[model samples]
Structures are given as structure tokens and as C-alpha cells.
Target: MNINLKYFKEGLKDGVPIALGYLAVSFSLGIAASNAGLTALQGYLASFLCKASAGEAAGFTAIKEQVPYLEIIIVTFVANCRYLLMSFALSQRLNPKMNIIHRFLLGFYLTDEFFALSISQDGYVNPYKCYGAAIIGSPCWCIGTSLGIIAGNILPAKIVAALSVALYGMFLSVIIPKAKEDRYVFLSIIGAFFMSFILSFTGISSGIRVIIVTVLIASTFAVIKPRSTEDE
Candidate 1:
């Protein structure tokens, strides 16, 4: 609660670009939510509570299909499980003395963008910085989803389809730079892509396929190219 204004302001500034990207991506997600028969307010609440696009998309699909609640839960969990790893890494970077409340709050806000920014900090993360980013980015995503639901109803199908690509573009923007810097990252991406494509032909659900591909590729690389202790 006693966040430093200076760090908070810096986090707000750093969050602007992330907020913009989320706006576009979540708009497309709203369209998906609409397709799933979700009301604008429901879509808004979903985005507000759950920041993972892949997980949200899978959940929406499950809703549309009228899948059993257990299946829906499993799909969402598998799709969002990567965040558990991100959370673990971020926990290690936190000050050891930070309180449980702040830790839980940061864990709740631990999206890919926020985790990347926080983990890349020089030392232990200032909770206020993450708070500042969440303030600006999270609401924009929720609002964008609501607007997207409204737009999907009024806009032409072609326009909605075009807008949906924004989410894919946002993901590429995140990964491409890292891939260029690390060949292993690039290879992992390529491997995941091919595996995902092959799995698409199978009867497995999209969410389950994602977990299978991610675990296999990540485990393979961890063994094949274990990081040095210095890197760790």
C-alpha cells in the first residue's frame, strides 16, 4: 500500500506500450467471446480477471461447445499453466521480506508482459512498479473486450477476422526479438509451431495440445541445452 511514487510513475510510463498492445489483442478476444454467446459485460469480467489470451480463447470455445464444466476447467488450466512457471521465477526475484499480500497481488497480475518487465529488472522487483503497470494495462484489456463484443455485433465478419490477427501479431512482437537474440529460443519456437500444426490434425482439444507441445519442447531443450550455473 505504501508504494513509492517515483517507481510507480516509471512503471506507468513503461506500461503504456503494453496497454496499447493489450487493447488491440483483447478487442479480438472480445470477438471470440461474442462468438461464444457471452454478453459484453461477461466478456469484460473474464478479461478483467484472467489476462491470458490463449486460456481465455480456449475457455470461450469450451463455453460455445457447451462442454462440461470439468473439461472447461481443465482446458483453461492447461492453457494458463505457463504462468505458474513465470510466477515461480518472479517469486525468486522478489525481496525475501515482501509480505504475503503483495506477493499474492503480484502473482495475480503476472501476465507475460508484466513478468518479462519485472524479471528483467536489475534486482528484486519493486511491487509498486508492477502495480503501476497493472493499473493501466488491466482495465484497458477489459474495456477493449467489452468494446470488441459490441463491435463484433455491428462490424462485418471480414473486419472482425482482420482484427483477430492483432492478437497473433502481439504474440509475434513478443517472441521475435527474443528468438533473434537466442538461436535456441528460435528453434524452440519452430519446434512448437510444427508440433502444434501436426497436433491440429488430431482429435485432441486445442488446450491439451498446447500443454503437450509446450512440455515436450521445453523439457527437450532443458536437457539438450541446460543453462550454466552463472546464467541461472
Candidate 2:
């Protein structure tokens, strides 16, 4: 396969910002993993495999709860369902003549940040750029997770607790921008928060409760405020 050195180098530069962000976010994730009794290596592997914040959150919740394997699978899928849509959008941006291997590899590398970078590029998207970004960004995520776990184990409890709050702050940063841009998204987020709060009083396990709240809130919004074709 021919490497586009220019695009690849540009990709590496683009990935730096993403790598830095992942280091902080995945550090909080590692603390959560440690709280869930995961070893540093286990947290590293999990972060390597499950790249999304929401997906990793759900997986760690399931593990902490000792939920059944099927429940874990279902929750993880539901949390990550948006990636399917992201993949569809990205597929349209790829060169149709691109090989299946590159297509598959790009799919694996399509985290939210990378997807935005890839989709915004002019002309046909080269898989090599995604590869370059992943090469730089992914290891930092994994290493950050490992470091978080180690820090959680060694650091003062109060310090770890404070650092863990960064994950929620990062989530708010992501959604607040979209919420400002789209009322429907804002409403959905509000509904999810309200529903999740109510569900907290129930005897339902956190895993099942999340699945219920997400499905209900999303389904309600999907029906009530269906996006126009242009929105897609």
C-alpha cells in the first residue's frame, strides 16, 4: 500500500491534541477501573479495546456490579450505538476503491475525535491518516489508563477522588457545545439526567438502569423530534 507521507504527517500532528485529551480523560477512567478492582494491565487492555468514554464507563459499571456477560454486552452496545452511525457517515467519505483491509482498519480507528478530523478533510479520506492518528493517540490512551490505575493505587484518596471528577467535566464539555447548537440534543440530555436521577431510587442495578434510561430517553426523543433529512 502506498503511504501518503504528507497526509500521514498531518494526521500525526492533528492527533497530538486528541492524544493529550485522551490522557486526561483516560486517567479518570483508569481511576474508575481501579475502584472497580481492575489491575493496571487490565485497565490498559480495556482502554485499548474500548476507546469510547461512555462505552468504557458502561463496561466498568458492569464489571463493578458483577453483571452477567449478556448484560455487559447489551449495555456496551447500547452505549456505543452512535459509532454505527459514525461509521456509516465515514464510509461515504472514503474512496470507494479503497481496499477492505483499510476500510476495516479505519472503522476500528474511528473514535469521535478522529471521525471529526477525518470527515472534515477535503476529497477522499485516506486510511493512512486515521492509522497515523491511531498510532499516536491510542497508546497514550492505554498508557494513561495504566498510569491512572497506578496513581489511584498509590495517591491519596482525596486526590484520586478529585481527579476522578475530571471525567464528568470532560463529558459536560462535549455535550454542552452540542446542547447549545441543538435544542433537541439539549432536551435529550436533560431528559437523560432526569430519568437517570429518578431511576437511582429504584432497586434496579446500575447497568440495567442505564440501559433503560438511555433506551427510553432516546426513543422518546427520536419519535418526538425526528431529525430532518438535512440534519443527516
Candidate 3:
């Protein structure tokens, strides 16, 4: 197994955005975990395993509601289904000649941010590149989360409250760009809120119900839309 310094450098460079993005997001997760009654260690553990923001949010929501563990797992899995697509995309970029062990190792680090960076490469990813990403990106995620947990404990309540806004701000940052570029995205946002508001009046589980409604509505639209001739 030859270690390529170039690929390592490339992975490190590509992982910079991931590190920065995780910093803000993990900070908010720390705050949320603390508020949700998780200890700092537990919060760090959540960040280490879950990594996905939506999963953590769903888990915390379930915890708050005292939902069954099965429901929590299901919600977290559903929230992260998009990662299946990401993983599929990344598989194409890996070296075909690589062994199963190598592939398995690569798959372990197939995070959205890491996949995005890996696929953006000009050619097939060497094992060293995947190794580099796992080495650098994994630590960034884990360390940032640990730091967030620590900060959550040390920071004053008022300061933590102010910092909590950063997560919403991050969400808005993603939403604004998609809304500006696509009318359908803008409509979906509005539709989601409307459905959620309506569902809130019911006595059933609002969060789970909202997720079901959104998925059903979105999937129905996708099925009804005419496919391009090229796609066919």
C-alpha cells in the first residue's frame, strides 16, 4: 500500500470546507444536546456516531417525546436516506481494482461532505486519497464535536442562546440559495410549512406526521412529473 503525498494533500485541502461546516453545525448540536438533557459526553458520542445533522435532530426530538427506541432508529434512518444516493455516487469514483477491504474502509467515510469532495476530483480516487479523507475528515468531525460539547458546558447560558441562532442561520443559508435558483424548491418550502401547521392542530405525533406528509406529497409529485426523453 503506497502512500501518495499528493492525494493526502488534496484530501486535506478538500476537507477544509467540511471542517468549517461541521464546526458551526456541531456547535449547535452541542447546545441542543445540552438543552435536551444529554451530558457533554453523551452529546459528543452522538456527534461521533451520527454525524448527520438531521439524524441528530430527529434523535433529540424522539428523546424529548420519549418515543420508543425503534421509532428513534427509524426516524434517524429515514432522515439519512439521502446518504444512500451519496454513497452510490461516490462508489463510481473509487478505484475498480481495489480490494473489498479498501472499499469497505472508504465506505466508512462516505459522508456527504467527504463524498462531495471526493467526487469532485478529476479522476478515479486512489486508496491513499480515501485514506487521507478518512484520516483528516474523521478527526475534524470528532474533534469539532468534542469541542462543541466542551464549549456548550463552559459558555454562559446567554451566550449559548445567542449562538443557538447560528444553526437556523445555517439552514437559511442552504434554503436561500435553493429558493433563489428553483421555484419548485421555494414551493416545497412553503408547502411543507403549510402542511406542518395544519398537522399541528391534530393530536397525533406532529413531527412524524409532518415527515410522512412531506415524503408522500413530494414523492407523488415526482412520480407524476414527466420524465425527460433522454432519461427514458
lDDT agreement of model 1 with the native: 0.82
Each model's backbone clash number = 0, 0, 0
Q: What tens digits encode model 1's per-residue C-alpha lDDT throughout 103-175?
A: 9889889887777666655567888887888899899889989988898656566765665564455467667
TM of each candidate vs. truth: 0.74, 0.68, 0.62
State the weakest 10-residue window (summed lDDT) of model 1.
Answer: 162-171
Stretches off by above 4 angstroms in model 2 are 1-3, 153-232
lDDT ranking of the models: 1, 2, 3
Model 1 vs. true fold: TM: 0.74
Task: List pairs with backbone clashes in candidate 2.
Answer: none
What's the residue-level lDDT of 228 in candidate 2? 72
Please report, in order, the local distance difference test score of every candidate based on alpha carbons.
0.82, 0.79, 0.65
Ranked candidates, highest TM-score first: 1, 2, 3
Better of 1 and 3 by lDDT: 1
Per-residue lDDT of candidate 3, residues 114-184 (tens digit): 56555545567665655665666566566666666567656555655554464444356546666686676
